[model samples]
Target chain A: MLRLADVSKRYGPGHWVLDRVDMQIPPAQSVAVLGTNGSGKSTLLRILAGVTRPTRGRVSGAPPVIGYVPDRFPAFDAMGSLAYLVHIGRMRGLRTAEARRRGQQLLERLQLVGGIRTPIRALSKGNAQKVALSQAIMVLPQLLILDEPWSGLDANAHDVLAEILDEVVRVGGSVVFTDHRESISGAYSTLAYRIEEGRVLAVERVAPRPRGVPMAHVVLADPGAECPPPSRIDWREVAGVAGVRSIDEAIHVQVHPAACDGLLMTALRGGWSVAEVRRDREAGRLGGGDSWAH
Target chain B: MGALIRYNLAAVVHGQRYVAPLLFFGIVLTVFTVNDSGPLANIYVVSASTLLVSMCWLTVTILNHEDPVRRSIQSVTAGGSSRVLVAEVVLALLIGVGLTVVGLIFPILSGSHHWDGSGLAAGVLALATCLFTGIAIGVLCSRLVVPRTGYSLLLALVVVIAVPLTPGLPPVNPALRLMSGNRPAGELLYPLSGYLVVSIVVAAGCIALTRYISVRRE
Candidate 1:
């Protein structure tokens, strides 16, 4: 088991990011860490991934092979995605030929759109995230840590990510991630906790929103003038957006009640304004109706 | 270890960060050697000095090539910060060997000189010392120590200029004074070897300190 004992982390003269905290990360489990912005979720993952040392704590039994995907994947413009993957794979202990081969396979599996030769900086943000995920899973690490892994991924890539995490647990490797969506944490994770005021608080599984009922109909504005919104191919990755129909440049979403909060959070986080939300007491179970489809 | 070195080398090379230092190397050697009939020892001093500044610049180039996010990912895979730092030092040394060879050769081609096996051997020792000294200062002034690019560059330039002028300092000042007489290569061998030893100790100490500080910074 990987574990932290009496972990307390504080920056100089600042508040304790984590105080007298302790947790166990057993193998074969998927763990989710949830917190508001600045709650130190990233710091905790960094310490657990062994990328950074805790201010005060003992961490032990960390696996021999580990993979990490940073929140913002640095898209180095100088090298292509395949070349970057190959370099990272080799650093993770794969042979040159194996690294090349494995990188090709993972990119294909992740459904990256750009050809292998495209520089990562030129690829869309979602594609770069795909590349980041590919590098980590290429060698089948004994431990996997991802920060905001679902951000920028589309619906298909979201499913692919779920399958990948399942594979990690099937091999008895542990997985940990930090995300804001409770439904995501609730759906996939065996254990989940939210950090508040430097403490990890266990989140009881919220009973799934009214079974089969389309609990909410949400209308969200298109992304602002700053950047183009994600294309349709990848639009629903955040919060399992089950159905999307465009009405006068606004997105009309009929979502399962359980995933409604996640969808709203993701939409807002993506810079889309939530214009309106209706209870939709007259609607049926989501994802089952062509009525909600464009 | 091989993978780490290759990755860093590839990053710097592809980024074109090494161009400035290599260009500096080419220009300095060309200026110091062309049309000079000086003794081999005097020419060798110039070669050694150029090698020092060039190595310092190159070492800093290689170390800071990766941004923080890329570095953290690599660190996670490499298992520790020290391994990454060691790979960087090893990469710098590999490049240093190339510089040393260039230093040993270009002078003979451009200038008149009397040289033999002893002269070649002393050239190797003197150049090796400069390589170590350059790496020491480079690591000290690199982002690992001084993070701001302007300050880092300023610190590097100041140290590179200051070290050679410090009297009796191994490999720089001592080598310059020894070469002042244009002595026979065989006569300068003993002192050059001693300077090489001191330079190695200094380089090793700097590497250790850098490794420690980098680990803590994360």
Candidate 2:
């Protein structure tokens, strides 16, 4: 957990860039700092990353290993992407071999393998951005901070970053980034903070969308030899059944609400005893209303 | 700090910024060796001055290559500004010492002049001290300016003004006098000691100032 108390930043005789902003970042979640240009989004991130010192107040619980991607990556004209990542990994305390290994993995994961030998300054902007992100993730940081992490990424790279952030949160790490594009932020973030006039105003937390397809729990008695093999059966022919997973004698069917009845009828007609029929609540509500009502 | 130093060394080599200075030093040595009509002391003086300027330029180049914003961020993530500054200063000194060896050895290798063991040692000492002084001034100037061209020009102007005005400063003046072969033989030990003390004080002071500026700027 990271907490800030009355943190403010101002230049010499200038208006406050950050005005006594207060914030908290809990573990296992992704938080976004949202605001317009020059609205202190980057300033807040810099402060959190410990790059910029605040004029007043205190910050605590900041992790020793922090991964930060600035809005603009510095032009390391002389170094190649892989070399730069390895250099950063070493600086973050990884051994030479480990740093190189992780650097290779991150470059491959981010689709930057082709540019591994290319000087950073010569790479395309999007690929350069991938290099920037790779350096940040070289070590599994306890707290990750990114400023407009998605701005220069292509579609595939964008999705890859989202998946990486999900993995970070899943492993109990925290991520704090700023993005003006609501579609991207809304899709990935668990909580958000809006900066207006240099203050952070809390926005309502949006619960995560349920993962995977809505699976219908179907329990059936052992099928006799007359029953067709589950793999050979075309479960899609049953109305609303999207897919089927058979575990021993029980078949877990993924179905749309309209096809739930059809799925049960097909099973009963096949002489399979129906032990129970109910929507998988853990799969999240499907299209709202009483998802389990049959 | 070790990693930072390694990274800086790699950056300097890869960027090839050291090429120009090394080439210039080589050219200076060739010119002095070819033009042997002048006194051996005069050759030493001119060559040492060129080496001093080259070392300063090398310092400026290293600092200029470092992006201040990126460095600040790296400092925060890596540890602190002092560690980064120490790495930079160590890198500059390492480069300075390496170049000093080359500069001092060229005259001997070319057989331009012959000197006894103590005389050769004194020459090496004088050159090394001057190079460090140059590094200190270069670092301070690099922090004060933004563009590389600006700092290079600024450093040149400073050397032009400072070299001639060395008479007013004691230890530095002695070191310069020794390089120029104007000091008495008996005064070598005293002046060399003074130069050593002054070099340490200046380098330390400049490093502290750079750290303070870096922190405050961030």
Candidate 3:
């Protein structure tokens, strides 16, 4: 178990960011820290990840190697996504062959389009988020900390991220993440720790998959010189393809993972590139642009 | 530590900010030492001082290459801010070593000055003195010690200009005095070695302070 005892954080004698907070994080469980912005959620996550040391307190029994994914991955890395993940894997104690293998596996599973070979600087927000999530998971860290992990993920990517979290817990690794609302992280986390006014309010248990059934959302490249923008939709009964709509000159199609292959193949066959494939499987959120600016 | 070193190397290479100091150092050394009959010790002194100042400028870029968000990601991945800060210094110093190599060899290859084994040894010591002194000044003015860029540049300019002007205050000053008198390498052994030790102490102090501040700041 990882524990924080009497932990406190302050910036130069100002108001407490986190005050005398005490908590225990056990393995094989997913914990979500819920708070609005500036509620000390990020500070708590940083301390748990060992990136920022608490001003005064003890963090004991932390895993030797902890993985951290910040709110947004920077858009200036020189290496492509695959290479960067491999480098991260090496630092986490994987051999070169093992690191490369695992990195490729994670990227494929996440369905990151054109992400493997493109420099991170060229990647869109949703693609960069995929890389960020993949880097942490590729290492298979026993302790994983993510800050606003869903900020830039699209519908299909969202579902994949949830599945990744479940795998982390299933493997007996702990997942600790912060989100502004319970509805955002509620579907994946097993335990909830809420932060209000720089203090841990209480611990609440979250039921598994309490959110609704997940639907796949595929966002395709904007129609332009690449492909003419479709002004109207004619195909209503394409198997697995649900609710086709146009937003910002791009087409979005909803599907379930179990029946998404046919639509994906048809899109590829039509010379249209897939910009993002994410899952829209959260409670009360569907069909919105997940690509935030880098 | 090796992995951290490798990661910093990749950033430095991508950032391409190092080329400015390196190019400036090469040009300064070439114009000052090329086709001169001045004594070898004087030539080395010019190269040494030039290198010291260039390394200071180079250090700023290396340490600040990544934005804050990227820096936090690296800190978490590498395990702590201390390791990240240490790796930045080590990488800067490693580049300084390369600059020193070019400083030592470029003049000799140009065949502009008569040289000897003792002169070469003395030149090496003088260059080492300047290298460490420059690094100390750079680390002091970096984000670790001072957060704002305007202040960092202002301090760097003041120190680079002020340190050389104050005779006997810094090793570079005394080393300059030794070469100006056309002194033999034998006469310089004790003084240059002592100055190098002092410069190294200053660098170590700066590194320790920067590491402490980085670890505690966030």
True contacts kept of each: 0.72, 0.50, 0.61
Off by over 4 Å in 2: A206-294, B33-43, B143-152, B182-186
What DockQ does candidate 3 have relative to the true complex?
Answer: 0.41
* lDDT for residue A289 in candidate 1, whole number 0-100: 33
Q: Rank the candidates by TM-score, best first.
A: 1, 3, 2
Please provide, for model 1 over B1-218, each residue's C-alpha lDDT reduced to its tens digit, 9 standing for 90 to 100: 89889988888888898999999999999998988887877888888998899999999998898888878888888887778888999999999999999999899999887778888888888899999999999998889878799999999999999999988776677876786665788998998889899899999999888877876777
Question: In model 1, how large is the Cα lDDT of residue B216?
Answer: 72
Q: What is the C-alpha interface RMSD of model 3?
A: 1.7
Query: How many angstroms is residue A217 displaced in model 2 relative to the true structure, after the best TM-score fit?
Result: 21
**Pairs that collide, model 1:** none
lDDT of 1 at A259: 68
Best by lDDT: 1
TM-score of chain A of each: 0.72, 0.71, 0.70
Interface RMSD of 2: 1.7
Better of 2 and 3 by TM-score: 3
In model 3, the Cα lDDT at residue A190 comes to 67
Report each candidate's C-alpha RMSD, comma-separated, in the order given.
7.2, 10.7, 9.5
**DockQ scores for all the models shown?**
0.54, 0.38, 0.41
Candidate 2 backbone collisions, by pair: none
For candidate 3, give the lDDT. 0.79
Candidate 3 chain B: worst-modelled 10 consecutive residues by lDDT? B174-183
